[model samples]
Target: MTDDSIYHVDGDLVPASEATVSVDDRGFRYGDAAFETMRAYGGTIFAWGDHLERLERTCEALSLAHGLDASDLRTRIDETLAANDLADASIRLSITRGVQPGKLTPQPEVDPTVVVYANPLPRGGLEGESVWDGPATVETVETRRVPDEALPAAAKTHNYLNGTLARAELEGDADEALMCDREGRLAEGATSNLWFVRDGEVHTPTTDGPVLPGITRRIVLELALEAGVPVREGRYEPADVLAADEAFLTNRTWELRPIATIDGHEIGGGPITARLSRLYDERVEHACYR
Candidate 1:
């Protein structure tokens, strides 16, 4: 790792290259971990409270009692950012079920591993520049998302083979892949929540299941309501997405990314998507830099 690159493993700060976990770590052996991807601007983590709340809830759901609390994690993030000398960056904080030998279930009292790292985003001297220059091209991949019955979709666990396989299906076809649920309904993208605008209203899949409750998605809904833009959440099919006037995606790393085309068919002019994108950035600026 470079001089600026450092990672916190457990409670110790070390170079990224020196960071290592045991071979028997549950996170490595069985994907027993919870993680959050966050963004920071001007050295302040955007939507940090929301991210921490989600992380705590996810860990609880996964039965992972990682000792680190929100305040502790926040201080670590600050130290890591200062050590890297980065004002704007993407941060990934993960906690695993710790080390266990050849057992399918982890011991209840096992010490969990906590890891945090930061990577500078493409700000390029302008704080308001878009992460991706334009829109993203998406395609419906063959891999379907695991049903909520099989595994809780709301838990941000390390078991991401579903998304990995779905992304693999888009190897050379599109910028990203959209996965369907077991019932053939539009679920979400590989790593983003899917949303579209139709008839002057915003629509997206309900968070009942089969979709990660994205922090950006939550903020977008709040902003839309504050702006008096009609918002609806429920089950939607591929036909509804294809027939929508405009479409976009949301995630913590890249707040809002408009979709240019889906399965080769172009979406509508991104009037609402553009509005929400601006509103999202405004929210970030107000929350993180004010």
Candidate 2:
């Protein structure tokens, strides 16, 4: 795709290449911003409500001014999608602390910057050929997740250096990186929530701490509950994940991705994951297409 796509920056709609942000913008300077990644199917954003809810919470926690509600966000997204002639796309909405004149402090009256843009979804699904096209291989990198004391994982802020560093360790050999918490307990993947299956039961980390309460992850849990699939959540170690029969990752763009191996150790069969995957796909189909 060319840089010809249209994007919404603040109150103006401009070409992607022409959308300029100030050098002094907090988002550009200190990563003082919040964002949401969404998927659009046939011009309709899937899970828009859930994404907006999380974004509002993030804004509140960061003391960033939020100018748009869900309805406003939907209208702006529709406008961008139409201008770009995009029906199936991956959408990103970013809100920043805005530009502070002379120094680092944000003035109370400064308006927050809002940007919304859409890019063509890859071949099969939103981001690329369905993440399910093949099994993934992951590595447990040395980088650990930022502790809740330092930065709450639930906030979807622009400060993602931790994940960036962890993913860099892959160097293209592994499909993804699984990060552990400060205490050496399995936390999550570089960009997705994690899950593991063992003895026909599903296991994942609790959202009370250390994990981004992903919208997709929430749906998976709901589906598991409905399907009568056994589910467990708590602190788990890498050894527990490595010993599982199967493992998977979930995110807004990629609904589900199965892990075939972790640190080169082959994961066993995926009976539990298979069932949940089917249910998750059906749920998405209904939500996005119906």
Tell me the alpha-carbon RMSD of every candidate. Answer: 1.9, 2.3
Error of 2 at 222 (Å): 0.4
Per-prediction tally of clashes: 0, 0
In order of appearance, the predictions have TM-scores of: 0.95, 0.93
Cα lDDT tens digits, model 1, 20-99, are 99988888888999998988787778878888888888888888877776788888888888878888889898889888
lDDT of 1 at 62: 85
* Model number with the top lDDT: 1
- Superposed on all Cα atoms, model 1 deviates from the true structure by an RMSD in Å of 1.9
Candidate 2 weakest ten by summed lDDT: 123-132
Model 2: pairs clashing at backbone N, Cα or C within 3 Å: none
Runs with alpha carbons beyond 4 Å of true place in candidate 1: 1-4, 123-127, 171-173
Residues 1-290, model 2: lDDT tens digits: 44598999987889987999998888989888999999887677888888888998898878887666677778888888888888778899999988888677767665788899998975333222573457788899999989887887889999999989999999566878899888899889989999998888899988766888999899899999999999998999999988898888888777788888888899844777878877876766676666
